[model samples]
Target: MAKILMITGDFVEDYENMVPFQALLAMGHQVDAVCPGKGKNDSIATCIHDFEGHQTYTEKRGHNFTLNAEFDQVAASEYDALYLPGGRAPEYLRLDNKVLAIIKAFAASNKPIAAVCHGAQLLTAANVIEGKKISAYPACAPEVRQAGGEYVDLQMDEAITDGKFVTAPAWPAHPALLRQLVALL
Candidate 1:
């Protein structure tokens, strides 16, 4: 089993955040979910994103996800893998300098890293996806491209692994994403 650091924040996709955290734990991996400015036992809000035949997914309030680790205390070397869930949270989480450093540390260490949907935003901010074929919600393709990554478009339920990076379009690709991650781990 691997030790994983799950970096997420308020308003992270409900299913995306919960499913992987639980699934990895069930697989005997130790997953530490953390959010900047939060500590163990603190909770973050989550939201549901549904494709309702609109131009994009619609959002709704979701469960309160509890944090099991303190963000300020995490050391990239302490974990064997990293998981980043997508949602509105990445938009702001990408702005935290420490967050960017943590992401870079993971990338530099050649550890496995997984990101879905808007999680690409953080990867781009950290400048770690360059020369990689990365996937994310279609809207994030431009950011991925601008970051020197080749944007890969795939079905909603698909995932792609390039080097140590595994990415997907959204939560629907969890099975594929996790499968690829398990292989990497």
Candidate 2:
């Protein structure tokens, strides 16, 4: 079994955060879900994002996700892999230099990093996806390209693995995404 560190924050997509967290745990892997400024027993708000034939995805209130680890207490080297879930959180999490550094550390070590949808936003901010083919929410295409990484426009249920990074369009690809990540682990 592998020990994986998951960096996430408030308003993350419901399915993206919950499913992988539980599925990975169900697979007997150690998953530490953490958010900046949060500690063990602390919880963050999650939101559901889904498409309903409008302009983009619609959002709604979701569950209160609990943190199993303290962000400040964990180091990237302590884990074998890193997981980043998508949602509005990445939009702000990208502003945290500490978060970016953690991502960079994982890339430098060449550890398997699995990210879904907007999760690629953090990857772009870290400047570690350059020369890599990364898949993310379609809205993230520009950032991916600007960061020097080839943006892969995968189907909602499809995933792409380029080296140590495994990414997908959204939660619809969780099955493939987790499988790819686990294989890399």
Residue runs of model 2 more than 4 Å from their true location after superposition: none
On a 0 to 1 TM-score scale, where does candidate 2 land against the true structure? 0.99
Question: How many pairs in model 1 have backbone atoms within 3 A of each other, for residues 3 or more apart or on separate chains, i.e. clashes?
Answer: 0
lDDT of 2 by residue, 104-148 (tens): 999999999999999999999999999999999999999999999
lDDT of 1: 0.97
Q: Considering only N, C-alpha and C atoms within 3 Å, which residue pairs clash in candidate 2?
A: none
What is candidate 1's lDDT per residue for 1-185, written digit by digit as tens?
A: 89999999999999999999999999999999999999999999999999889987899999999999999999999999999999999999999999999999999999999999999999999999999999999999999999999999999999999999999999999999999999999
- lDDT, candidates in the order shown: 0.97, 0.96
Which candidate number maximizes lDDT? 1
Worst 10 residues of 2 by lDDT: 35-44
Residue 53 displacement (Å), model 2: 2.0
lDDT over C-alpha atoms for residue 82 of model 2: 97
